[model samples]
Structure formats: structure tokens, C-alpha cells
Target: MDLSTLMLLCVFAFTAGLVDAIAGGGGLIQTPAALVLLPQYPVATIIATIKLPSFTGTGLAIGQYIRRVRLHFPTAVLMCITAFGAAFAGSALLTMVSSRFMKPVIFFILAGVAVYTYTKKNFGEHTTKPYSRKKQLWYAFLISLVIGFYDGFIGPGAGSFLILAFIALLGYDFLHASANAKLVNMATNSGSIALFLLKGTILWSVALPMAVCNGLGGIIGARLAIAKGNHFIRLFFLCIVTATLLRLAYDVFVKN
Candidate 1:
């Protein structure tokens, strides 16, 4: 890649990290940016390359969240493990099936999420356990398995879906949900990146510098979300979800 193209990818990665840290739609930005930047590469290669920057940024965000926000360690760990395994399996599935069939389904699901979140004013505002510890763990496992697979196979708004699931199923507030989502997302991204590396699919030349910028953006965005608190995160979450829904709609309905 040329210096200009590398810089552009880093810029997009930074933007993606910033948005992703707050609301979890970074792939909506980074994936398209990668497609534009590396048009010659296969779609899977671009997806794999994007995971490197995303994983780096998410790792930083997870660290910041662990330090500042309270985390449910047991649930988080269970979900992380489930997500790791599920994502690896999903990555393996990517070699067998095309993801195009999944796009419309995901688009509809994101639309439902947007509508549900919009209509419910106080959703994700306060933390309260709707389920017992064991039940919550079970729910977490299910969520990690489904969404982590989606993340590895055809990621766009996986983080948004995770945050919503954490809020609705576990009764976490937006801030706490976001914190847990970051850790799970980090695990999923790590699994995908490992698989991509094993397959020799990622472009290290572009990913390294972008990873640095993405990590920096993650730090800034995480701190900002911490300072702003739950209300801000909730609003940002809605916006990102809406944007993601629209983007997916365009891709599924208009682009193809």
C-alpha cells in the first residue's frame, strides 16, 4: 500500500474505534473503508485485515472499561469463552458458505433492534438483574454463541446486538452493557484474527499502523464515554444502531 492509502485506512480505523467504543458499529465504517482502500483483495481478505485493527482497539477499550466500570467476571468469562469458540467455528464456516445469504436477515434484525430501542425510552438506563446468576450465564452463553458467529462470518453491528442483549437479558445499564460487550467483542475478534492469520489472509502492511490509531481512538472514546455516563452511551447506541440498520438495508436492497 502507498503512504496515502495507509494513512487513509488509519484515519478510518480511528473513526471506527471511536464510534465502536461508544456504541459498537465500527465495522460499518472500517469494512467499507477497507473495500475502498484495497479493492484488489478478496472480500474475505479485507474482512480479515479489518479484524486486526478492531481487535487492538477493542482490547484497549476492554482494559479501560475493566478499570473504570464494574464487570460481572463470571458471566463475562463464560461469554468470552463461548464467543471465542463460536467465532472460530464461524470463521471456519466462512470457508464453506457465502455470507450474502445472511445479509438480509441481519438487516431485518437490526431494524427490529432500532425500533425496540427507540420506542422504549428508559431501556438500558439503569442496571437491574432480570435473571438469576445461573440464568444470566446461560443467556450470556447463548448470546455469545449467536452474535460471535455473526461477527466472525459477516460482521457489521455485532457489538450493537451484544450491547442490546446484555441490557435486555441481563438487565445491565448502557454503560455496563457496553463494558461487557467490549470484552466479548475482543474475544470474538481475537478468534477471527487468529483464524485469519492461520490462513494468511490479513495484510500486515496496512493493519499495523491502523491498529495503533485504532487503539488510541479506543482510549479516547472509552474515557469520553466513562465521563459522559449511561445516558450519553444510550443515545449513541441508538444512533449507531440506526445507522447500521440503514447501511445494511442499502447493501441488501440497493447495492446488490
Candidate 2:
């Protein structure tokens, strides 16, 4: 890549990491940037390239969140384990299934999340454990499995979906939900990156520089989110999910 192209990708990666650290839709930015900037590459190569920066950014964000927010280690560990396995399974299945079919399904689901969150007014504001410990573990595992598979299969809004599930189903506040989401996101990214590495699909030269910028942006964004607190996160989550919903709707309806 030329210096100009590399610079532009770095800028996008920085912005993507910031948005992703705050609200979980960073791929919504980076993927489109990759498509436009590196159109010559195969889709798998583009995704692999994208994952390198994302993994680095998410790792940094996880560190920041862990320092500021209290996490449930048992649930987070279980989710991470299931998420890694499910992500690998999903990536393997991608060779057989058509990811196009998932677009509409995801659009509708994101739409529901937007609506439910909007109408509830105070959803995800306070941490309230509505379920028993066993039930919470069961729910977290299920969410990680499904969303992790989706992350590997289709690759957009998975973090947002995970955060939403944690808030809505698992009765976590947005801050804690986001913290947990980061851990699982890192695991899922690692799973996908492992497969891409095995296949030799990643564009390492482009991804490494982008990863540095992404990590820088992630650190700043995670600190901001931590300082600002849950209300800020809730608002940002709504905006990112809405943007993701619109983007997916365009892809499924207009672009298709």
C-alpha cells in the first residue's frame, strides 16, 4: 500500500477503535473503510486484516475496563471459553453457508434492541440480577455461543449484541456489560485470528500499523467511557446500534 492509503487506514482504525471501545460497532466503520480502500483483496483477507487491529484495540480496552469496572470472573470466563469455541465453529461453517442470509435477521434483531431500549427509558442503567446464579451462567453461556458464532460468521455488531444481551438478559448495567463484552470480544477475535493465521490470509504489513493506532484510540476511549459512567455508555450504545441497524438495512436491502 502507498503511504497515503496506509495513513487513511490508520485514521479509520483509530476512529473505529474509539467508537468500538465506547459502544461496540467499530467494525461498522473499519469494514467499509477496508472495502473502499483495499477493494482488490479477497473478502476473507480483508476480514483477517480488520481482525488484527480489532484484536489489539479490544485487548487494550479490556485492560482499561478491568481496571475501572468490577467484572464477574466466573461468568466472564465461561462466556469467553464458549465464545472462543463458537467463533471457531462459526468461521469453519462460513466456508459452507451463505452469510448473506444473516443480514435481514440481524437487521430485525438490532431493530428490536433499539426499540426495546428506547421504550424502556431506564433499561441498562442499574445492575439488577433478576436471575439465579445458575440461570445467569446458563444465559451468559448461551449468549456468548450465539453471538460469538455470529461474530465469526457475519462480523458486524457482535459486540453490541453481546453488550445488549448482558444488559437486557443478564441484568447488568451498561458499564459492566460493556466491560464483559470487551473480554468476550477479545476472545472471539482471537478465535477468528487464529484461523486466519492458519490460513495465511492476513495482510500483516497493513494490520500492524493499524493495530497501533487502534490500540491508542481504544485506551483513550475506554478511559473516557469509564470516567463518564453508565449514562454516557447507554446513550452511546443507542447511537451505535442505530447506526449499525441503518448500515445493515442498507446492505441487506439497497446494496443487495
* Full-model lDDT for every candidate: 0.89, 0.90
Q: Give the TM-score of each candidate.
A: 0.97, 0.97
Lowest lDDT block of 10, candidate 1: 125-134
lDDT at 197 for candidate 1? 85
lDDT of 1 by residue, 1-256 (tens): 6889889999999999988998899888888998988999998888888889999999998888889998878888898999998999899899789888898988888888988988999998776675677787789999999999988887888999999998888888888899999999999998898898899988888888899989988988899889999889988998998889889888899999
Counting clashing residue pairs in each candidate, in order, gives 0, 0
The CA lDDT at 89 in model 2 is 81
Where does model 2 exceed 4 Å of error? none
